[model samples]
Target: MERGEKIVKRIDTAKEAKQNPSYFEALVELLFQLADDDFIISFRGSEWLGLAPHIEEDVALSSITQNTMGHASLYYHLLEDLDIGNADKLAHERQAVERRNASYFERKNGEGSYLQEPYYDWALTVVRQFLFETMKKVKLETIINSSYQPLADIANKVLMEQPYHLAHWRMWLKQLLGSTEEAQNKVQFQLEAAWPACADIIGLGPKAFELEKHHLIAGEDYLRKQWLKELEQSLSLPSSLFVDNHPARGRYGEHTADLDQALSTLSEVYNSDQKAVW
Candidate 1:
């Protein structure tokens, strides 16, 4: 299936979970994975605001941030249904240690501050987001077929808005890879940086089998295979064999200081106004 077309066909689903206990647990884990991935990455993306290489690129990238933020919000709302907490509080008030996001998403955007000493790397940003979103699209595609109705339903809705995100990143990848020698080299460097922990993003955590057995979603191994296949066919671009490995697993809640730092930043506002409407 074509990359864009794959996303388009993933838009029909029911928004309710199956009334089985195992299924509910699987649904919860799936939601956490989805929420954490987007929440952490979107935070990183937000840090890039006004720091992109070009003005047009800034506007273009912001759309992705908004989309990821929207995805996070959707998961937060689902958590609310389980009486977890208000969506904003869940997003903004949690401590770093309590966060369930992967470490990679929480990494700093290149180096220096976005406001001053801004030494951002466009290659890293583009490659990381592109690769991450590509895997995310794969996972969401499987979720649309989940037995848990609510998850499948939300997945369907999310799939509708994912094409632009995929297209935007694909364009960046193509242009940079096809650009000047320096640009191609930089992209290659970023891809290498992203390769090691890329597997963490696809992890199904501690409850992988249970989640699958309950029909909450597809199995981890299956999803991983699908993700790789999708990546292979994502764009008619490069064809070099890439190495993928995971030194630290994020699925079981194993994380790094990066996530700790990110949770603190994201929760600052919500933590302060936990009692307020905003």
Candidate 2:
């Protein structure tokens, strides 16, 4: 269903990468940024497994979570193809300081655990997932013509499935916001909380110029504008959505204890014995 697939400029190979060090450096950085964001968010989604408001929602959410994690794996494998390391290790064995996901993704899905005292907020999930899925589509579109042909191919493959994810959350956001005052208030609170760090989520981290310099991806400013425009058209956003602070800047290796806690849980099975075959 992918239409008008562009002819991508594939990199010759890591062995033939004769460019200066910064080119590969930017490539790896971008890969980490893409992989880590999806990884953490999917982990968050896993936490919501079987804990959605109802069974049908739970099943649908699980499917979306699996798709997201699958996307992350595709990125990690891309890194592995670069001989960065094993994809499993990159996903599970890294220190929090080495990750590149935005901090908001690692935040708890409201308070309490899924099995006990499951006080997870559906409104927050609706808003956050809607915003993230929209942003992810924008990023993927920018990468569809990526200079790295392998990644461009993956982007095209992923673009086929991404619309469903965006639609699921967008429907949740619209239905909830229009339904009840309480639901709208809850979503509004999430929107306010998300606004401050919204800039970081859309940022290309510290190496934006280098990535664009090598024709790796779209310009960061252009990306930010596109993302913001899409968000404004979908949601009732403030006229001036200024980012005064970052809850955590994962791109710069800056994160919160939330990420630390998340890593421990996500890596529990893998870290039990890194050598064991799963």
Candidate 3:
């Protein structure tokens, strides 16, 4: 039998059929968004695996990358039970248009390719991840109280393991932002560059209305407002520094060239033999 056929047969099993259907749809969409975002970004993170500026920091950072990928796998497996697709195929083979992830997560690490002249901006990475994880933590907190039992259960599980991701990024952000002239300059530079795209990650895209209305997740404004509050309090930065308008919303499927490049790189292996079992 063809690999796709085998995957289909496996997905058609009892566990797939046993879910509460209504909750299943909502939960699946949430899972896809969560999983795809983490998967793509973590892949980007892995590209920096050996290229990090410091060896000790490299080891510590890889742990977060692996954890995020692991979380993505959990969501993908959950999706498999819902008959979406095989976990590996969904993660590795999908086109950018088919991917439900945010553009922020898909953006490049820096100016050069990971394989060459990897002048990666560690400060940008630190700032973007710290900001992103802060929002994710806030949202996950709310998700833990969701009306959908499955989501709430998963959210609880994710939260249990999330502090490490948060702490790691937060430490990087604080240290860089609070450090010497060069470090602070680099961090500030990246933070400003990231300011415009930061909104896209939190927008929740086309399904925002439905997700919130159905209680699958919280509203954008609420999450944004709360996230800003927490960030301001934590960083003690001037509140006036943040910009209100995020020009492009990734939640709406709007993306940049970086996303396209990233999609091509990540999907290259899976798309090669989508029909094969391996």
lDDT of 2 at 257: 88
Model 1 bad stretches (over 4 Å): 1-19, 234-245, 276-278
lDDT of 3 by residue, 1-278 (tens): 66663211112232543464654555666778888778877887888888887898789779888888888887888788667888988887766666777776777887888777877777767877787788779888878766565556778888987888888888888787778999988887777766666566666666666667657678888888888876775475544443536554555556667877887887777678777653
lDDT of the candidates, in the order given:
0.74, 0.84, 0.73
TM-score of each: 0.85, 0.93, 0.82
List residue ranges in candidate 3 displaced over 4 A: 1-26, 236-247, 271-278
Cα TM-score of candidate 3: 0.82
RMSD per model, one decimal? 5.3, 3.4, 8.5
Which candidate leads the pack in TM-score?
Answer: 2
- CA lDDT, candidate 3, residue 270: 62
User: Rank order by TM-score, top first?
Assistant: 2, 1, 3
Model 2 clashing residue pairs (backbone): none
